[model samples]
Target: MVINFGAGPAKLPREVLLEVQKELVEYGSSGMSVMEMSHRGTTYVKLHEETLELARELLKVPDNYKILLMQGGGTGLFAAVAMNLIGRTGSADYLVTGSWSAKAAKEAAKFGKVNQVVPKPAKYTCVPDPKSWKLDPKASYLYYCDNETIEGVEFNFVPETNGVPLVVDMSSNIMSRPVDIKKFGVIFACAQKNIGPSGITLVIVREDLIGHQLPTTPTILDFSIVAKDNSINNTPPTFIIAVVGRVFAWIKRQGGLQKLYQDSLTKSNMIYAVVDGSKSFYYCPLEANVRSRMNVPFRIGGPSGNETLEKEFLKGAEQLGMQQLKGHRSVGGIRASLYNAVTIEEAESLRKYMLEFLAKNS
Candidate 1:
């Protein structure tokens, strides 16, 4: 009965949780939990391979791409990407649209030169026009994050980079919407947010981008090595991969990316309507054209009013089985993360509660 709105490690599908519960003691007749199995064991290997294949199918990933299941989260991939792709020249163009993209640019700076393309208005309100970007033709790759979880800004259009390879960090909004994987050379996401669990990170890189790691890069951190070995270079996160496989099956059963995209749009529109209908009582700072469909952040009023409002909302919602409605500590506003697991009914419940709360407070 509880509703969870935390960003990462967020709520999972009820059927997925139930399936996990049923298999917690015996997995596929193996008489052991997926976590108890050795990563190198045949059962685990099958699970891993099937999981990767299902994910590729769900995303409709191109044949030229290799999906890798790696250990580090999105943060690790940021450094690994710079190390591997930003060669001796060590220069790349970065689009700074949100906190995550800014962090990626900062991490890339440690390895080489990074030209950060700052969007105008000095904040992440909307995506900068592609024509305005001062991109370096000699740069390794252009890096961006598709959605900023904290800021609630999302890129509605892909940048046309001529021949430059586009790399994206899709950590918080990977499976929430449909994306053309062929348009990018690399797309990496931490699995905890949308896929399944926290231990595994998914990287989909074009086969051509694989073998270019700098000599200083660790072998384990190299995408070429991981891709070549089918992500079995070392002990994989077997339990997480198993759960991700379940998620993939669930997505497939729910009718693939197109259906997911529709569901996300519907849920997002529903919530936005409620926020917009609140008039001055609710304030969403992000530009409407670039608002995120996955993470909706808003404030009730000024600092004091926002604090009191958030407290009352959280207290009342928690009593009614809604949880994790608090915003990010850095932002100090409300953030309601609507992952794939959150149903339309739950969203409506939240909207109903908000309407009632505003009526009482205002």
Candidate 2:
């Protein structure tokens, strides 16, 4: 069976998929698929509430924070967050570390003044030092993307906001690791990577930050309405949310987020070891301090691009039942996304293939 390494909509736990299939035909004698159930139906309501409660419990979110299960991916929140929070101050500060954060800052600019600490496009290797940050004390919120999937860069520590509310987009790395919930004003992640599947978005926002929209924000995008109504303002992604609830249950059963984080560390360490030992045959671009544990991007062969050999490596990997190993189009090479569901054995298989490919090419 080919393993998936795609960044978002990545591989899922086998048990979860199998379980979902069993429920797909008719959910526990409710006589309808979750997709067919009404949003007002009791069966769907229980399913939704359980999932939301599980997320709140698993994340150990502060009581002051409200966890809203809403529609829209992280990209949607980029606009929503700007409209909701920018009302307080007409400006916001953004720490642009990689592609995602840079994009978020650009979207935020449409609603308010954006202070991008980094004036130029980021190199997408190492994270900029906090000491180098030019934060605006008067800004409404300090925004950052916790991990950049395409660039394979992740932050090692939380930034000190000095009472300035902080918002983090944790789409790529949420649930793979434990986070200090008290650190940020908002923690939002879409359910495509570590959670379950695409179409559902999870937002954990401090209750105090909920109701400050500029009156023009869409009712659906308004944090107060979404939070108060329990995220069913619209029809909601019922089927996807059901799948996410199962994923959350699986995580809790698998010894919680701490255990999953250790697995991620082990998986990433194995891959990095192969690259580091290859002696320039395989090299990672990101700096030592900020290498991501969820996504590892590396280039094969020497500098100046080895597109042909990289193609061969990907072909060989596919032949060996590994697919989605090709790097993103923007930065081509290889990207192995070790989301919570990606197995260690799969990573080891890729490592072995890499070593074999290098030996043959050399």
lDDT of each: 0.86, 0.89
lDDT of each residue in 122-145, candidate 2, tens digit only: 367877777888999999999999
Residue-level lDDT of model 1, residues 1-362, one tens digit each, is 89988898898888998999999888988889998998888888889889999989888899999999988798899998898898835699999888898889999998889998764355567888777889888888999999898888989998887778899999888887778999999999998778897988899998887777888888778998998899999988787788889998998898887888888888888878877887768778878999898999888874324787788788998999998878888777788999888888898888888889879887
What range of 10 consecutive residues in model 2 has the weakest lDDT sum?
117-126
Q: For model 2, what is the error of residue 259's alpha carbon versus the real structure, in angstroms, after optimal superposition? A: 0.2
Tell me how far candidate 1 lies from the true structure as C-alpha RMSD in angstroms. 1.5
> Model 1, which residues run further than 4 Å from truth?
119-122, 302-305
Give Cα distance to truth, residue 316, candidate 1, Å: 1.4
Q: Which ranges of candidate 2 are over 4 A from the true structure?
A: none
**Per-structure clash totals for the candidates:** 0, 0
